[model samples]
Target: MYKLVKPLLFSMDPEAAHHTVSGGLRSFCKLWGGKRLLRTAYGCEHPALRREVFGLTFRNPVGLAAGFDKNAEYVEEMAALGFGFIEIGTVTPRPQPGNERPRLFRLVDDRALINRMGFNNQGVDVAATRLRQLKNRENLVIGGNIGKNKLTPNEEAVSDYIQCFDALFDVVDYFVVNVSSPNTPGLRALQEKEPLTHILNTLQQRNRKGGVSRPILLKIAPDLTHDQLDDIIEIVRETGIAGVIATNTTIGREGLRSGERLTAEAGGVSGMPLAARATEVIRYLATQSGHAFPIIGVGGIHTPEDAAEKIAAGATLVQLYTGFIYEGPGLIKRICKKLVAG
Candidate 1:
């Protein structure tokens, strides 16, 4: 059904199609237990699919990754589609218009996308307001992924993270500290030991002092070195943050089936080509932490086997971004059903 409608969708701008899909979903869920009926039909209900991690009960291990619903606009719609959870936004403290137009692109031949979206979203406060209304829904776990403003100097980035932490503490289930997006200038530099520790520790401090604390997870880029991954593990232990998201998108273009110009496009590449390196990162984090820490595996997870490989390699759960674009909502049922087989 979606495949037939996809060409019509692809004819429009990527962002426009995203909004259209979200609006349609929001309306569909209003149709007399429409959300419930869709979940009963499309969602996987096997008990083996349930996994507890970071103080939350996920109906299944598969979640739609952040950057899909950057402002919490379609959490209910996505939940209706049978995703166990959804991560919303790489939201900033203050809303910004992000980069120029045509920032998102699709390469159909490679089943990949290149985006320099620059975290374009409504600020944390607006997003939190939208999210606070959805708290009572079932089978819908939302993770708030936050980041610094584009204009904020890198030195003062922690303050931005702190602001978002305070505003969204009561709304989201888990917090993904996003310092790995390639679109934001100098954002990846925060991945270094000293800066990363400062941000994580400050957020931890605020979380402890706040009325209610949310699980804080650090999201890293796959482009980091082994030494950097070790630093992340040490930081997690030192700060006692909940878990690690293991990866964001990567700038590396290795092993792409598409030609030079597609690879040469200016942005982060995601989709099928990201699988191996992302799984390797998950394994490395597991090995480095002695499997004591939980990691959410995300990258090129397009099939049941790709998801199972990440779980075996030591992911507490898995997330999808580009795969969701190429494969449609049924991908969740496909992956979760396979988990029941094992």
Candidate 2:
């Protein structure tokens, strides 16, 4: 099991182990009667877990967030693990190698992660190709979280988002415009009002004219002030966009239990320490916007209580990234079952 292998995995370089886990899943799922076997093992058969949102029906409410499966590589494998939905890709119009190594770190004592991975992905075209090959599933909703390449100047960032939208329209069920990753140089600046409006407005126009008009949502960082969050809510309403993912990861490191050793690691923080801040953002969004649209709450959700907090705060659905790394697959079932039972 993962518990036994985790120590070995923890010893490897974080990024390398990430690729290894993803690659290993791909290989394992290819073996004799593989993917179907996973469904039997990891799947929850309860009907109470089903829920509908975003005009789609999810088998469960828990989803795997974008960074976990960036290139659309293991949707089938992850789907087997009983996540109701999966958002793949912070993919760009073009691919880049991302930030340098040691870019990802485990703050083990705090049950958190700090990663400076700068949207390194295999480009939208490559991801779209694989996505197109997926056996269609109306049940398991897939969200495509798209972003610009790191080297692209922020001025032309909208072009990258637009291209990714056009390319992945036929494949993904929903879209998340990711402008909040801390690792990307100058990317978070796009979340500011003027630039955020420009990027979202362009995508809204395209979606209106497109073949399959999937719902589009913006993902925001938790570090924003009340004024900035108000700008975000205004833009969401103005653009007639779908919704918001309440948070990305946090740039702030205040009051972390991981101590200063982790304080020195230059990256975005997520996991248990992020729970209060992310839920606070969700609650703020809920209160400010008059509950205008849906919200996908993510960050530090590793327990049934955490999931409940997200729902209570106003997230129609929730996602997990660091939680999965720390708590393993059981966390999904636990959260989902708790939600369903309640």
Candidate 3:
């Protein structure tokens, strides 16, 4: 069904296509037996596919990455497609419109996307309410991917993270501190040791203050040096956080086969272009840190083999965004079947 529609979706603007697909799916799921029909067609379940990571039990290790569901609007709609988890938001404390139009672009030749969305979201409170209202969340693992507002200065970034954390605490299963998106000006600087450590420590402090603390993970950029990764390892250990999401998106356009015009678009690139580097970061974090924490590997996964490679490279779990878009829903079941076969 997706193959038949891919060409039509491809003809539209990338961001507009995304909205159309999401809205269409939501509307489809609202029909009689729609969600059940979706589940019957796409859901894959096996004991072998189950995973226990970071004090949470995931029905499978495959998850929907953050940017796709930035406002928590499609949690149940996506859950029906058989993802083990779904991450929502690079949400901020205050609502802000994202970067200008044409911010999201598709590079069809390279099977990748370049987006400079600038963390546009309806604020954390709205997402929290949406999650809180979810009725069928029994086995679903939801993660809140939190970030600072674009207008907030770097010095005051910690407060924004804290506000998001607090607002989402009761609702989300885990928290991903998003300081790695390249679209946000000066946001990556928070990945530096002093400031990064400060933010994590502050969140950790709040996380422990409650009766039950949710696991917190740091999301890092794939563009980091070995030294920076070492700092990341040290920060994770020092902060006693749960784990790491090995990459956000990369600004580097080293080997893209797409034309110069699309390649020159300023933003982070994700999809097939990011697979090797993302897996490399996961392996580095795992080996360098002696596999001390879980890693959720996501980037360029368009097939079951790509998902398996991340697991083989020490990713406790894997996620999909671009690949999910390009490959369609069957990719999740195919990946679970592959994992079970092994």
Instruction: Name the candidate that leads on TM-score.
Output: 3
lDDT (Cα) of model 3 = 0.95
- Candidate 2 vs candidate 3: the TM-score winner is 3
Q: Write the per-residue lDDT of candidate 2 for residues 169-260, one digit (tens) a residue.
A: 98888999999999988888998999999889999888988356889999999999999999999999999999999799998888777678
Worst 10 residues of 3 by lDDT: 130-139
> What is candidate 3's lDDT per residue for 1-342, written digit by digit as tens?
999999999999989999999999999999999999999999998898889999999999999999999999999989999999999998999999999988998988999999999998999999999998998895899999999999999999999999999999999999999999999999999999999999999999999984899999999999999999999999999999999997899999998989999999999999999999999999999999999999999999999999999999999999999999999999999999999998
lDDT of 1 by residue, 21-85 (tens): 88888888889998888788778788888889988999999998999999988888888788888
Which prediction has the highest lDDT against the true structure?
3
lDDT over C-alpha atoms for residue 132 of model 3: 89
Please give the TM-score that candidate 2 achieves against the real structure.
0.96
Cα-based TM-score, every candidate: 0.96, 0.96, 0.99
C-alpha positional error of residue 198 in candidate 2 after TM-score superposition, expressed in Å? 1.5
If the candidates were sorted by their lDDT against the true structure, best first, what order would they fall in? 3, 2, 1
Quote model 1's TM-score: 0.96
